[model samples]
Target chain A: MSIVRRLGLTFGLPIILLAAWWFASANSTDFFFPPLSEILTALKDEWFGPRLLADVVPSVLRLLAGYAVAVVVAVTLGVVIGTSRTVRATLEPVLEFFRAIPPPVLVPIFLLLFGIGDGMKIIVIAFGCMWPILLNTVEGVRAVDSVLSDTARTYRITGTARLRTLVLPAASPQIYAGLRQGLSVAIILMVISELFAASNGLGFAVVQAQRSFAIAETWAGMLMLGLLGFLLAMLFKLVENRQLAWYHGLRRAQRSS
Target chain B: MLDVRGIKKVYEGKGRTVEAVRDLTFTVDQGEMVCIVGPSGSGKTTLLKIMSGLLDPTAGEVLIEGKKVDGPPPGMAVVFQEYGRSLFPWMTVRENVELPLKQKKLPNARRKELVDESLSAVGLAEAHTAYPWQLSGGMQQRVAIARAVAYEPQVLLMDEPFAAVDAQTRADLEDLIRDIWHRFQVTTLFVTHDIDEAVYLGQRVLILSSSPTVVRQDLAIDLPDERDQLNTRSSPRFAELRAQVYSQIHRPKADAAEPVGAGATAVDGGASGYGAAPDLP
Candidate 1:
């Protein structure tokens, strides 16, 4: 597809939805449902200034720290698990059990251990976000083609060189799939973690606006969070495109021929 | 300088025991190109795997220069049949070719030089930046050849490397292999189901019987040094050699290498009959 057409496909629905929301709430009188103009005004007043720095910076940093931890730990563990049948058999069921527990449920458990500090919130995000990436990495590593592995072996490309040139690149497509899933999980956990016994963050700000009945500001905070999530996803997609160019190109070549 | 000493492979899996290769033995001399031919289900791949140290034989061993190969030897390289899967799709043609050289720990200048020379040798000089998947099947196989060539191994092993490409491409690759074999003088073991390919590229063709497989005949190719796609293939000698190999594969499984070919006459319209085995059966 042409870039213009792809851009149209991506942005077309959101533009229409935003326009619909603008007119639908234009004459609203309910306190919960405010005018779009009021929400925009609230957005500017609430976050387009000093508060943006004080709250958003810390929230984003926490999200990043937790996400980095998740990615590193998951991929490392995933490779170990993927490479060995014994390890996979022993740990997979336990990992699946943990995965089934909703991440929000763990926020309380982490809070009990760490208390309501940055550590608790960070752990909450990290623990919540690790599953998808971990599982995907295992699947990817396990699925590395046998012919490629044989070629590597016969050529004596062993140890770290084998890992870097063969295993990692072969498993990256699926790892990226996991990373994408984990991103959304991290964002959600970031908000939910702040909602419990937290004084400042994107989630805290939203709750504060709600408790004090700053309805428009509360709506604005949510709008900002959604937009933030959208922006992060777009950034991730950019990186994925650059990284998996070969995979995509291969698929294209295969399909056309 | 490669030896298969009493190699046997039995695949025991899924409540069944299948003997893939049964007591096979052969040898390839230094700087010689030998092709192994057999019908389907003849355990050709299993034998190659055992020889290449990718898989262990149930009994026996492969030796390079009289040393037992317990693992993939540092002085050998393999070009697999599935060129699509064998070449790393994530790497460009140059990167794929240079990877094994890097493993060999050659310095940067020499590595680049070998990669460049090998790529050009296989007619892939202009495809350095292209990914393996972006190239045609033949081009991808050339990249694989370039990789094996760049490794500069004492021995090179290929398993049906041209099975996937079109006929035209296959002919080109066959010539390329013979050209590389002559120039570098790397002892090569080429395995293929195609009798014509085996006859064309090999100095000697090792004809294998059906599973449980064994060497049926070790026939030396008597074609001239100068060979081409058109003239060499149409030669009566080429037809005669291929006919012998073709017949050998179709015959009932033989438990031992046969002592034949001495009394056989050359094909029709040929004055110079081929000689008997230069080495013992």
Candidate 2:
């Protein structure tokens, strides 16, 4: 599709959604079913208010910290396990076992250990995010073309130099793919952890507003969380595009032909 | 210089051991261009890999300048058939060419000069900043060639480097390789299944027999050293050399129904047709 047509299609769905939401709430009598206008007012009030900023800042900080930790640990472990058959064999089963366990299921355990503080939330987010990045990294490293590796070897490139120049760069596109996947997971777990146990953050605000029967306030919180996730994802995509510019160009050329 | 003596390769698969190469022996002198040609499954690639130090021979040793080659040698470089995979997609042409120079620890100025010279020689100076995927198949192969040449290795091994390109591009690449070979005077060993390419590119071509391969005949190209695709292909000598290789390759299969001695005689006569050229040391 043309760029303009794609843009129209994107806006088309949101327009339909807004219309449905407006129509449904217009005839409702319950105070919980506020109109779209009231919900918008609440969103503006909450977003522009001090409480909203405070919650956003803490939530963003935790997310960033968890993501950074996940990236470092997963990439390091992925490279080691990916390149060594013995390490992969020994760790595969254990990694699979851990990966299959849902991050929310471990919240009680983390809560006990870290005591329901920011530490517990961060740990939960990190645990949830690490798998995709680690597995993708392993696939990326293993997917490096053998011929390129041989060429590097032929040029006397070995050890750390080989990893840095050949293996890592060759594997980066896939690693970035993993990062994108991991980032989405991290966002989901961040909200889940905060909603389930946190005293602050957007998720906690949503739960608080819901309990108070302030439907507009709850809708505003949900809207803010959705916007945050979208923005974070967009930011990650921007970084990925910059980092993988060459790979994207190649893909474009491949598709065009 | 490279010497391969009693080289053997046996691949163990499932429950059987398949002999890929057996007791192969040959030597390439300094500054010589030697081509190895054989039918499919005749282990030409296996021998090239062993010679290039990419693979170890099961029974014998490969020596470069009288030194045993147990691994990739410092003075040797290889250009593989799949140029697309051999060149890093993430690296620009200049960076790809400069990588080996970096490995050699060459000074930046020297490395830059060598890279520029090699790229210019291959007519890719304008493409220095372009990534491999941005170039055509033949252009990518040129980058691969430029990379190997920029390394300034004492010996270069190419395994059917032009096999993946179009006929026109293959011709251009062939000429480019010949020009580089002449200019650099680096000892080159080229392996190809194409008889014409083998005769056209090499000063000498080694024909190998069928499975459990051995050198059947080593023929020297008596045609003038300078070559052009149109002029050389039109030459009577080129046709005679190609015809001789064809007979050698097809002789065993065609004579299979003949008496054993008769088939052997046909093979001997075919070998002698191209073997009349003066030998290299």
Candidate 3:
């Protein structure tokens, strides 16, 4: 009963919101607040047309490239810093200071260095996303169960085999937590970085349409961004479900009566 | 097969020092089954860690087959007390058992044979693919045992492996371990606080004193080689040996207060020659 009802409640809110929007704007004639039907049509034409190849593809590729770079760098450095006290002490405060400064505030600095190109925007997204992953990985690596570590040592499981089988899997739950958080930040920065600088992207498309008073296209772009966020979240969930099945099973068992 | 010569461990940290083990010295002969019994916090664990080469001693050294140990000796495996934490939660039972074998660089065929045989020995054949967290505490301990058995180490160190389970399950696991030990003929060092368990399982029981611990007594168990949960425990000889071990662990310096054969807790059959006036014999 709980499972079925909760699932029902999940889809219930989204359906209700869509229904309200469709009805409230269906009869309106305002140029700014266009009808939901017209907005949906524009969303389809704008996204599913040639504009997709130019705008959506580039935006997604930048986001993915940035996220990939962040995942690798953060996980590698996190493990190093987490395992070594000297490195952690030397670098942690600086990382904290960097993380504290809002990512959007760094756009001007990135633009100054990398120019108004894909490289600058990509680096900004990577920088914004890297912190959660790095911090969580560090905490996770440090908190690996001492007994498990001792077990590996007693078995003479050293070097890469030790890291791959023992350290990485033990720290994965926390790492995934950080990855999910970083994904959200990545998405936000993907849009924010382009808002001030980019020639093409979902954020650019929306801003450009608004300035030209193509209000329907602006709404359509907003809708597309929302869809992209939803789809990315779903994609992450799929990967996490496959990768973290054991953790999920454990959690489910823990929660079961 | 294993030798511990004057091993002492002093943990120094943050301007504080703890002498966990003090001059603990003993030798476990090849194929010997010994149990070390101590009061809680008597540093039985610290001693075991030193023997297993997981910790360096403050003074002396552990020698495995005449090789001085600085790190985990290549020929040793340990089943820790915290089964929940010791078993890798991310790995399946088979994977956990195979991990050490992979470290040994055993051929794939030999690794599979050992894992299969060891799992069956501990009755976990169907649980090959199951994660450690999915199993019951008793079963998890069995997996740990299977893992140690699969490693085929020269010396197997078990630190209160059954302490986390129910009484009935603990009894069953005790029998399982004894069976594994006999079949494999690997030297074993089992640590526990339960006197009955120590007496029932070990060929020689090493009693340990309280904090800053030392070996108090080393009593040879003189029971028959064949043992069972019911007859071996209920036998008068088992009771006498149990009484002897209990006295050694609890009343080490107070031996003159009561006859050694006087059981710590009275047995069902009283006034036996073994328990009462043995001088009449």
Candidate that would win on TM-score: 1
How well does model 1 score by local distance difference test?
0.89
Off by over 4 Å in 2: A1-7, A23-28, A255-257, B253-281
Top of the candidates by DockQ: 1
Q: Write the per-residue lDDT of candidate 3 for residues B72-173, one digit (tens) a residue.
A: 888888999899899988889999999999989999999999999999999999999999889888999999999999999899999998888999999999
Give the per-residue lDDT of model 3 (tens digit) for A151-179.
99999998899889988888899999999
lDDT of each: 0.89, 0.86, 0.87
Candidate 1 or 2, higher lDDT? 1
Better of 1 and 2 by TM-score: 1
How many Å off is the CA of B246 in candidate 1? 1.8
DockQ of each: 0.81, 0.63, 0.62
Runs of candidate 1 exceeding 4 Å displacement: A1-10, B253-281
Q: Candidate 1 on B49-158: residue-level lDDT in tens?
A: 99889899999877787778888988999999999999888999999999888888899999999999999999988999989988889999999999999999999999
How many clashes does the backbone of model 3 have? 0
Q: What DockQ number belongs to candidate 3?
A: 0.62
lDDT per residue for candidate 2 within B225-262, as digits (tens), equals: 98999999899989988998777777765443332222
Q: Measured by TM-score, how close is model 2 to the native structure?
A: 0.92
Candidate 1 per-residue lDDT over residues A112-182, each given as its tens digit = 99999999999999999999999999999999999999999998888889889999999999999999999
